[model samples]
Target: MILEYSNGLHVGGDSVKAEEIPNSKDRKYYILARLVDGEHLSYQRLSNDYFISRSSIAHDVELIKALLAKDNVSLGFDNSGTFISGGEIVKQKVIKRIVTDLLRAADDRSSILKLFIDSSSITRVEEIFQKQVQSWQLEVPEYYIDDIVISTAIVVDRGLLGHHIADAKGNQLGSLLFQFDKYPLVYELIKGVEEAGVYSFTPDELRYLSYIVIGNGFKFFMKDLQIPASFKSKVKLLISTVSDGLNIDLTQDTRLHADLTVHLYQMFLRLQAGTTVINPLLDEIQENYPQLYGTVWYAFSDFGSDNHIAISDDEVGFLTIHFQAAVERTKSAKRVLFVCPNGIGTSSLVSAKIHRILPEVSLIEVVSQVDLVRQDLSDVALIISTVQLPAQTVPVANISPMITTHDMKTIMNRYIDVSMDGSEQEVDFSHIHSIPFLAKDHVLFCNAKSRTAIIDSLMAMNEWPNAEQRNMFRQTVFQRDTVQSTYLDNGFVISHGDPSLVSHSCIGVAILDKSIDWMSNRADVVALLMIKKEDRKSVEPFMNVIMNGINNKDWFISRMMEISEHD
Candidate 1:
């Protein structure tokens, strides 16, 4: 029989009977009392905890809920997250179900007797016979009594009377008939034996006993007889008894792998009860069998928590310090160069102008076109020039003769700066004077007339004796008009290339005595052209440094433009 529990009692039999209800009443009452005492019970939770079906628990709860509602006693859940309603009542009902079922199983014998008898009348006869049957009058040998009890139980529980009739030797029943008749005699033999005692059995031995007594013909006969309601319970009891007798060492058997332990435990609970007994068995295996312990431990090792910590504070700190040093080094240095067409005079004039405007920066000596072609110009940052030099040389800043002091300041301040204070310093322009002739490759000096006229005159000369070169030079000078000589809002333009294509390397100077309308803006300034060759790769590095230096407001460009007109 599949036994279920509500309290301490088993709730099932071959057929459920009304007489078993009172046995479960105490549990039901206790459940009601607990509900009144403020404990909540959920049908699903109880079902899972008890290994019974939710439907069964729900039925029991419904009965309790209905009974409690009858007395105008309202059961309700509280806002404190507890089911204060019918907990005690429900728990009592569950207990009642268990107790009642247990008593029903213990008292009912008709259901047990019908297993051996086909006719219902035999059930009554068995009951009467049981009452009149003589109890053991004296002590008997344990083995003999055990044998008699087992045989009598089988006959009485299985209704073996139905199996008794004429055999093949039909004269009169012989030894087999006597054996059947003597079942009561065996019953009397063991009537006084204690109900509870410990026994053991191996699984194999239990299997053999089950096959011998319950398999094949016996199974068919029991089914045919429409046996007692309690016949299933008796069968279960017999099988359990046989299993206990076998005493199998289930723990050491590898056939019972750990993965199947839960399933095996559940099966055991269905057949018997209690899991506490399995603990000692497990401990014994763990101690005696190292291999099993190792395997199980290794299998579950991934689930173990790891608590290792890794540290790298020193390495990270060192890397951060090194990077900061590199950045600071780059931020402090500035370099520049000025270039023109000849080694004569204009280069010196422009170089002087640059130095006066930006005193903080170190300026390289001005070089003429020929000198620039001959020298290694790799380190130069800015090349101020009137002519287009070789590509891949340096960054160039181009300008016209009209460049003024304000224009120079604007160009330098917009593109380059040099200061260690980390605060912006403006370019100053107060001490500047007119030199008679600033000479390097070409001559440059302040005059009442335009400097462009002198440049045009120089290009027309044939004193160098290269006719084609002179013509080319003249064309190059004229082409400067293509830049429109217009002063933009921030600076002035004085070149032929597209403003967009011209690199910012060229420092354009604007020389103005008074504001004059040159294009749309007012200006009459000297623009120092800082133009590099169009194809210089090293130009970017130069531009980065010079632009940063000149972009500061306090720098050289303003100082150069502040030169006195009278000197």
Candidate 2:
């Protein structure tokens, strides 16, 4: 084996090098790790161990003090020597952070983990944890399980060394202690560790461990876990916000609902405990799925600020996977368009009949064959037709005007075919050339510095006949924006208001002179999409254009700006 340094590579054979001192940077980390592990420290004693002067130890302590100050932690000294001044939980957070920073990219984490426990001890803890998880059929994200194993190992190591996490203070997490019995995985894992007789735990210590269980994605069984109504409401709001923003339907996606409910609950508990898992695929998720990632990020702005925890990009990356999967699951979300050659009376009657029988389909469009050619079929998942006079790309279900039970079954089967079709659809660039509301006065520039300012500037440009309607439109859009922002990944925003409140469908575009903070992200371009209640389907063209702008930001925005400047 050989070791490489700035000077040169030194061919070497493994032997005792006890006299060789670790560099100052490595030495400081070792000292800090020992401090985090509840070790006694003093300049005199430290100098004895390192064979260094007391002033040299004092210099190291100053650097350590600066690092601790980042977390509002400080060092206190007395006649007995030096000690950490933060609470017990804070120390655990430091330990967990150290472990995370070490294990983020390491193939073998046992080296840094040895700061808390030996290699053999870590192995023992992992065996105990894995057995409990398998024996109890406990489901947890593998990322979180690794953190739990390290945390449990640290607890055992500290306990064996005559140091225990103090828990005599009134417990802030007592409410969760009861869940250990409800969630047997918690009890079984802790019991398994105890049975080994490696470390006995007190009542307070058990309570702390119980919290560790609940916070580390142990609430895997969603049906058995008791979720607060408020959390359920928030989840519903999240789905609705994303649905409205993307112009798609996900309200009936039970899989998305179930998975998000479980994931978010555990995420909240983990955040409250100050423990976080790193995502190795965060950059890839952010880059590949920019639109979905941005939607999820903006959707979580209020939720995070309200809870006072900045939702890290890694957490957002984890959540984007669930939403992206739901998107694929719902791609063939059938948008049945019932067309009849007859007038409005007959077409409406037949379409209403189809909807009445298939109550599961929330949206059904009633259109005449004459109007079918004018419709935007980019988002139409399936079409039900009474007249088939031409060949087209979209799959059509031919049925009589007086729809029967057999017709309903046929439509259902066709919907299944469309839903399961994995063939990809190309981006709809046909509508980008003729995007609506591109007049010079409509595509106005603004010098706003905030979300509220930009929204106000854009709203004032809308062609409202009266103040009452304008105020109503403004209030609805404002309230929805409060619930979930409409910012996109590439610094573009697509905010909309109640379509019924508008007399006509038109877009008000805002081009910011500079980027403004929009919720948790930034935005330099804003589009106010206002549609009439009857023109809901027409919004597809506008969405395609917005997506093109997000995906091809430089060219799209520059062209739009040039057109705006010349128009």
Candidate 3:
């Protein structure tokens, strides 16, 4: 069952061979495990054990110390050397992190656990945990299941070592997470572990274990999930922060607010316990949705700092997925009004063609030319017509009566252009972001060596109401850059400050003589966007322009560079 849960977690790791000398990552995990397992380790002792020098071992220990400090866990020194000393809960957090790292590097989780825990103990715990989750018949996400398995094993390993929580009295309210009699999963698992001669858990320990389950995202399963009013407010603040930064009103997005409130609350529990669930699509999400990812990261940073909780990039990435969905939701579409002027037989043919080709159009209303004049077109997104319709307010796709192959392709392209799923839509390569951008006077070539120089050069070209406002805009740009570099994979950085700080909505472009290293990659061209609150187009379609422009680089760069000297 454990193997079933651990079948295919591919978190970018090479298979770690035991015969090979441990790499820095592997060595760090081993050393951290030893310290957490009550082994007093010193530089010289570690040096002798790994046949490495004392200096190297000291470097590793120093790095390990910094990592533990971030989690509020301390590396303590005594007459017996050095070991990690923190509350039992925090220690388990460290243990879970270590286990998570090891899991990333190996396919066989049980083999990895056997290094620190007895094989028999791991097997018994895996069986009990699997049985309980199965009994609940819950469809838990695989990434979540992986997280719980690590945490559950950690509880058994650490609890039996006599390092149990002294008193879970403070968490008495939280112990209600698992009503042992009603929800026998946690209760039965603990009992089974002790019966299998693994470890005897105290009442406090039992309560702590319930938290372990909850921390690993068991709260998502609780049918009577009650979110505190205070947490809901924080969730709203988070949404508002991102909304303010983007200049888009998401407050009215009741579904977004509801979904995000739940997600952040679960994330809050995970962060408070120093537990993190790996998001497998993190790389793809951050890459494809860089702006959304950066905005969410900045918002979450504030949310965590305000609430005194630490947020991980993984958590930020997860929340970004929710917001991305929310942003797409804002691109609301109405029913597609299919207009057919031909006979009923032809109208039926057109309807069948659309249903077969454009499966994305959920609702299709076929209207004759007579009905088109009288029908309320307010709710229609698109009009697929067999004949020309004059003075149409909605986008009209006038196609051949037969709806040829070319017609299907053209209509699909048009549908994609006006759709929310426009990221995958084809963009015209020759089309420059000239309209509304007003970059002719601002776009200029530069010999800048650094990103700051590029930003400074571009900033000087823009009109600011005052020095204070200029500094405020600059600060926001840098603040966003800190969260995630605006560097695109195509050697271009689309930099933008907060929209509200802009006195006049404008954009500036800089093409450098040489490519300098931007945070993620190298960049030669940088675009600074200063959008005022009223300018809802936060460099929209332009982002798509930059992304799709990657294939036609020479033409795109030459075109953008030429914009500098445009009249």
TM-score of 2: 0.51
Cα lDDT tens digits, model 3, 221-296, are 5556578898788888778777865567887888888888767777666654455666667667755675566566
Report how far off residue 476 is in candidate 3 (Å). Answer: 18
Q: Could you give candidate 2's per-residue lDDT for residues 1-567 as a string of tens digits?
A: 000221121212333234444456555656776677556687887766566789888878876764554333567777767877666666765666566556674576553456545546567888988887787686677877777777777677666765677853344446655565566666777778889876787666666666666666645532376778898888888787666656678888999998888778877766655545556677677656655665666556545644545455567788888888888876455577888887788887887887776687777888777778888888787789877747656888888777777887888788778765533345565445456555555676768887777777777766888999988988877666554445555788777766678996777778788876565455788988776745544555555556557767776667566656663
Off by over 4 Å in 1: 1-335, 342-346, 406-567
Each model's total of backbone clashes: 104, 0, 0
Error of 2 at 433 (Å): 14
| Global Cα lDDT for candidate 1 | 0.33
Best by TM-score: 3
Every candidate's CA RMSD: 46.7, 13.9, 10.1
lDDT of 1 by residue, 289-379 (tens): 3222222221111111110111111111222222223333434344565655554566667667777777766745666667677766555
Scored by CA lDDT, what does every candidate get?
0.33, 0.67, 0.67
